[model samples]
Target: MKTIPVQLKSKDYDILIGRGLRAQIGTEVAKVWSKRKIALVSDKNVAELYLKEVHQSLEDAGFDVLDLVVPAGESSKSLAQMGDLVQQMADAGFTRADGVLALGGGVVGDLAGFTAASYMRGIAFIQVATSLTAQVDSSVGGKTAVNLKEVKNIIGAFYQPDLVLVDPDFLDTLSDRDLVEGYGEVVKTSVLHGQDFFALTGKIKSVQDIREQAEELSIHSIRYKAKIVMADEKESGQRQFLNFGHTFGHAIELLSHGSLRHGEAVSIGMVMISQRFEAVGITEKGLTDEIAQRLAAVGLPIDSDLVGTPLFFKHIVNDKKNRGGILNLVAVKNVGEPVIVAKALDDMHDFV
Candidate 1:
């Protein structure tokens, strides 16, 4: 097991990366949260898989435990679901002193964290990520949100978790499609933190290879994101670097009407961004090709069906980083290097 510390402005937490850590949550986390009641929030899929063991562990620790299950998928991360979960917490007699245990993938973590942050002001959150995407990226950062009617994560907050418990063993139960879907995040993170690219790329020859490398790559991606989020806790400036492939990624998600997986859209978006970087002469020769080749090698689509650059650009403008009509576009100077460029929606004609 490897441990990484995430130091935020108001709180500091640790991300525990290994197999079978879920079973040890009681022993490992009891000291830090001995007094607070534990609210176990997970999706129906995960609740079926491991919720009982998780619930028993917390109960055995003598902490008041409330287990709440939500539907699985992106739709679960919404204001309506958030409202329902908060009511569940309230019905369970939760207090501000209590903390939330997000026990599933990214969607669960985002919605649970959002609920914890908004309920009675705010509370601590613990991430027990069961999906590769959540464990590697979304579960580590303080960025918590529920999707709005017209946008992805349109309504959200920055509430750091108290601890992140990653159990790689969960990957064993993940469908091949979900595992493949998460590889997109791994590849995106690897591109930004290039030192791991070779190792990450070599671990998988095809989509079928995801299971073997999912755990290691997930840890690597989380550590990469942690380095950036820790440096800029509030996203005041530099943390935007973590949005390297997210600008177009979010747009793709929006354009697909939620049909696309977050990482799938991100994989396609990264390719488009790389191409745009090359077209603008911001990228080194052949680097864009390498990006596409690597993504394709793992079954992620490099080309997008989102034609009509103007329409796609419209969705880009809807990003959270857009301030005063300027979208903070995360582009790459090279594989593993991220630079933020502030551009108006109209200025994206050539790129999008």
Candidate 2:
């Protein structure tokens, strides 16, 4: 197993990447926590697939495990679901000493992390990320949130997980669409890391390729994010670079009404934003086409019919990345160099 450390001073933790790490979660958690009540949180879909083994492992390791499963989807990342989770934990008499084990993908990680962050002020949590999105992005950054009705991830906190366990074997069970959506993140990270990493992604033509290189790719992505989070944990500065495609991507997601997956929308968002950057002389002339070709090669959508709709503009205005009527847009100068541009929200219309 390869381990990447997210150095956050007192909040430091390790991301363990390998195949079959799920079976060792109990022992892993035991290393940091001992003889405590534990809550194992997962979504119905993930629970149906791997809950039995996870529960058994924790129970066998002497943890008093409590099961909490939510419905699977973006909708579950809402205030209502978060409140219900808090109520369940309260009803079970859990305290700060008892931690939460997030046992699914991004949705589960966000909900469970937020639940742990809110319950009794804050409690520790571990991330057992099953989805590629969570493994590479959401599970490591200490950014947890539930979506508001009008926007995504508007209500949340910077609650770091005690441990992050990634088992690439889980990818073998994902549907092709689910698996393809994950490549969006991989592509995003690769581009931000620079041209060489971006070129490496060009070789991935299928989910089989992603699975075969999961450990290496995951570590590279995690290490990139870890270094950024450590430098600017609160996103006040350099960390905003991570939002490269997220601003437009989130707006697209809101407009889709669940029709577009986050990564797919971001795939389109990265392409659209790259074109915008090129138009303004921030990126090279052909950077947009290069990004589109890379996205299409991996089965991700490069353009969408909703590109210039009023609904799209409406959601973009509501994005949290905006401050004082200006959006801090992340633009790429090249494969690995991203710049933050402060543009008036009204000016965003020209990009569309």
Candidate 3:
């Protein structure tokens, strides 16, 4: 198994990446968390696929496991779900000493991680990322959140997991849309990670190509993000760079109301911001088109009509990146050159 150690000051952990790691879940979980009980959290889809294997593994290690399976979708990431999941943990007699094992993609990770972060003032949190998006991006950042009706990640905390398991074999079962969804994050990372990595990612032509390179690329993206997170675990400075396409991407998500996936929304946001700025002599010329090509190469959407509209502006203003009314938006000047452009919320309308 390949390993990447995220050496944070308060919460240091290792992201274990390999094939067939699911069968080894018990040994892995046992090594990191010495506590007794583990509340394994998963979504309906993922649980149906791999829950039994994981459950048996954990049980073999002598953990009193409580598997909580919720409906699979963005809707599951909510205040109501959060309340219900934690209440279930309380009823199960979970305490600060017990741990939470997140067993699906980002939504499950965020829901389960937050459940761990807030339950009895935070407990052990472990992530076993099953989707390509979770393995490449969300699983490592330690930012746990649940979306509000109109806002994204408004209710969240910086709670690091005790461990993260990224098994590339899990990507085999992803639907075409689900597989393509992950490339949105991969493209974003390639763009932010500089030209060499960008060129490497641009070479991927299809979902098959991505699957072939999943392990290698997952390591690259996680290692890049882990470095930034260690430098700024609270997202105060360098860490903001990780959110290369998330500013307006999040707004587009709210506008879609579940029609657009997070990856699709971010793909559009990345191109839109690049195009808008490149037209005005801010971002490098043709950068937007280049990015759009790479995204389109892997079947990711690069345009969204909902962006730049009045309702979109309303949603963008509520972004967490906005600081004291001045929105600090990330824009690309060139490949590997991303800048934070702070604009007053009032003048943001002029930007569009």
| Candidate 2, backbone clash total | 1
TM-score of each: 0.95, 0.98, 0.98
Residue 313, model 2: Cα distance from true site in angstroms: 1.7
Error of 2 at 23 (Å): 1.6
Q: What is the descending lDDT order?
A: 3, 2, 1
CA-RMSD of model 1: 1.6
Give each model's clash number: 0, 1, 0
- Give one digit per residue, the lDDT tens place, for model 3 in 22-94: 8899999999778489898999999999998898899999899998999999999999999999899999998
Residue 39 lDDT, candidate 1, scale 0-100: 82
Model 1, position 132: C-alpha lDDT score: 82
Poorest lDDT segment (10 consecutive residues) of candidate 1: 195-204
182: Cα error in model 1, Å: 1.4
List the lowest-lDDT window of 10 residues for candidate 2.
194-203
